[model samples]
Target: MQKISPCLWFRNEAEEAVDFYVSIFPNAKKGEVLRSGESGPGPAGSVVLVNFELFGQSFQALNGNSDETFNNSVSLSVDCKDQAEVDHYWEKLIDGRGKGLACSWLKDRYGVAWQIVPELLPRLLIDPDKAKAARVMAAMMKMVKIDVATIEEAARG
Candidate 1:
């Protein structure tokens, strides 16, 4: 039992969202699901809450109203080991109705924000050469999805 878990609120789409998320992550799966009862606010037998895990991180999905929606204020960051890994996630996430944003940020079909970043990003940003680091930053700012090779080239300049 994790001490704290992020709860995602969906407009009666918790089940679908959980399934989508589990399918994307290798180590993820659905756990328990609680359905609303006849006297509950939602339709009887409809999904009320779902427990799941993504990359070993526990999370709960709630089938609530659309009064609240996902925003960029909070986002999940995926640290990829290489450009291939970064591209894989970036492509997979934006395959359906997702949109790509600048600086490796993207919003999934469910409006969930994700940052697909390469592990080399931190190393490049903290490089001893300030000019190289600035170049990397400038290059990253111009990209919707991060290209590790491009960043490396920028750092080398």
Candidate 2:
């Protein structure tokens, strides 16, 4: 168990979101479901809270069932080893509904913001030579899905 976990407020679909999240990631699972009682905030047997793990990180989601929405102020940044890992997450999470934003940022179907960053990106962006780093940054700024090879080329040139 992690010392701190993010609690997501969902629009009455925490279980479905948890299932979708766990299904896409390796070493992920649905931990437990907390249901509403007969006294009822929601209908009896409705999911009120969900505990789940994604790639070993614990998270709790609440079935808020409100107008509150997920926004860009907070995000899940996925550190991928390579482009393939980045692509895998993008495809699985989006599944055609998510909007791809600049610089590897994406707003998924559930309105959750994600950064599909490749490990190579940081190394290139923080090179000892500021000019090269700037060039790499410029290249990255133009891309939605990061291309490691392109970043590397920008770093060299």
lDDT of each: 0.91, 0.91
Which stretches in model 1 have alpha-carbon errors above 4 Å? Answer: none
What TM-score would each prediction reach against the true structure?
0.95, 0.96
Query: Mind giving the per-residue lDDT tens digits that candidate 1 earns over 29-145?
Result: 899999879898778888899999988899999988777899999999999999989988888888769999889899999888999999999899999999999999999999999
Off by over 4 Å in 2: none
TM-score of 2: 0.96
User: Tens digits of per-residue lDDT for model 2 on 1-157?
Assistant: 4799999999987898888898889999898899989987799999999999887789998999899999999999999999899889989888798889889999888898999999989888888999999999999998988989999899988
lDDT at 15 for candidate 2? Answer: 90
